[model samples]
Target: MRILFFLAFFISITCHGNLIWSKTGHRVTGHIAEKHLTRKAKRAINDLLDGHSLAFASTFADEIKADRSFSKYSAWHYVNYPMDIRYEDSEKSKYGDVVMGIETCKHIISDKNSSREDKVFHLKMLIHLVGDLHQPMHAGKGDDRGGNDIQLQWFDEGTNLHRVWDSNLINSYGMTYYELGDELEESVDKKKKLEIQAGSLYDWVHESHQKAVEVYASVEVGEKLRYQYGYKYNKLLFEQLQKGGFRLAKVLNEIFS
Candidate 1:
C-alpha cells in the first residue's frame, strides 16, 4: 500500500501542468485593461463582444479547453525558452506559441475582411494570451515542463512550481478579481503605468523570462512555501499583473485606433 501510494503521488506530481493563469488572475487583467481603454476602443470592443466586458471575455480561451477542436491551441498558452537563450534565438513551436498566438490573433482582428465571429473568437483569445504571456512560468524553460515537474509543498499541501505561481500565491490573498484589480491599479503612478506599457511584445516576453529565472532561484524542490514565500513574491506578482493589463490595453487601443 505504501509503495502504491508513493507511485500514485509521483505520477500525479509529474503529470501536473498548468493550463493558464487562475480565473481570478485573468479577470483581474481584463478588468485592469478595461479601465485603460480608449473611448473608441471600448465602444468597438463592446460591439465586437456583443456587450460582454473584457473581464467576461478574458477566460474564453480557457473555457473552450473542453472542446477537442481547441486541443490545437493548447500550445498557445505558453512559450518555453532556455535560461541562456532569448525567444527570438530559440527554436519555435510548429503548432503555435504564445507569441505567435498573440500575433495571429492580432492579425485576424485587424483584418477588416474577417467575419464578426472570427474577430470575436480571436480577440477573446488575444486578451487571454496576453495575460498568459506575463506569467513568468508561462515563459519558462522547456525542460521540466516549465517547472511542473519540480514538486514542492504549499503549506503542507503537495504542489509544483508552475501551480505555485499560477494560483497558489494569488489565491492566498483571498480577494475577488475586482478587489485585487482595484488594489493593483491604485498602487501604480502614471509614470509607472507608461513604463509597464512601453515595451514591444518581444521585450515583454523577455522580461517575463527573466522573472522566471528569478522565481526558479527563490525556491528548492520539496520546500514548504507559506507566508514568507508569499510575502517575498507578492509585490512582484502584482507588478506583473498590472503590466499585463496596461500592455493588453495598449494592444487593443492600437488595433482599434
Candidate 2:
C-alpha cells in the first residue's frame, strides 16, 4: 500500500498528458533515425542522392507513412497530446528526452559500422524529431504537456492544447511547403543561412527551447481559438517547418558532402 501510494503521488505530481506526444514523436523519429556514414555510408548516400533530386529527398514521406501505420500505438497517436512534465521542475520529461534522443541519434547515424537499415531508421527519426523539437509544447516547461490537456474550443470544434499547436496551428495558414520554402529561401540572408547551417544539436535544442518560451508567453489554452487565431499561429508554424526542412537538407548535404 505504501509503495502504491508513493507511485500514485509521484504520478500525480509529475505526470502530464503531453508525455504521450514526446514518446510517440520520439518513436516515430527513431524508426527513421539516420546512420552515421563512413566512407561507405557516405558513398551509399551519395549514390542515392545522385540518382534522386534534392527536392524529392525529404524524410517526411517515410515518416508520415510510418506514423500512419503505427498510429495504433498510443505513443505514435499521442504526438498531438502533451506530457505531464513541466520545464520549470522536470527538465528530463519525455519531450526534452526526445530532443536528447534525437541528438544522440544524430551522432549514431554518423557511426561507421551502423547498418544501412539503422541509417534509414535514424533518417526517419531525425525528420520527425526535427519537427517535434520545433513544437513549443515539446520544448515547453508547463504542466499542460505544452497545453495538450488544456481543454478548449478550436473554432467551435472541441480540441486540446497540444492538438491546437501540432497541426491546427500549421494548417490554419493555408500555405503549402513549396510556397513556404520558396519564401524562406528567398528571405534568409546568406549570413543567416550560414549561421543556421553551422550550428550543432545543442544549438538546435536551445533555439527551440527559446522559441518555446516565447510561444507559451503569447497565449493560453482553453481560450477560444478561431481561424484568425489559427492564422496567427500558422505563420509561426510555417517558419518552423521551413527551418526544419532547410536544416534537414543542410545536415544531409554535410553528411554526404
Across 1-257, the per-residue lDDT of candidate 2 in tens digits comes to 99986676566434333332232222222222222223554465556445432333443322343233433222322122223423233335353355555665577677778877776656555555565666666665545555666777878887766666665665555555445455556676767666665677556656666666666665665677787776566666655555555566566656555
For candidate 2, the C-alpha RMSD (Å) to the true structure equals 9.8
Q: Top lDDT: which candidate number?
A: 1
Worst ten-residue run, lDDT, model 2? 72-81
Error of 2 at 75 (Å): 7.8
Evaluated against the true structure, the overall lDDT of model 2 is 0.52
TM-score of each: 0.93, 0.64
Model 1 TM-score, all chains together: 0.93
lDDT of 2 at 224: 76
Residue 215 lDDT in candidate 2: 69
Tens-place lDDT per residue, model 1, 113-222, is: 99999999999999999999999999997888888889999998999899999999999989999999999988889998898899699999999999999999989999
Which sections of candidate 2 miss by over 4 Å? Answer: 1-96
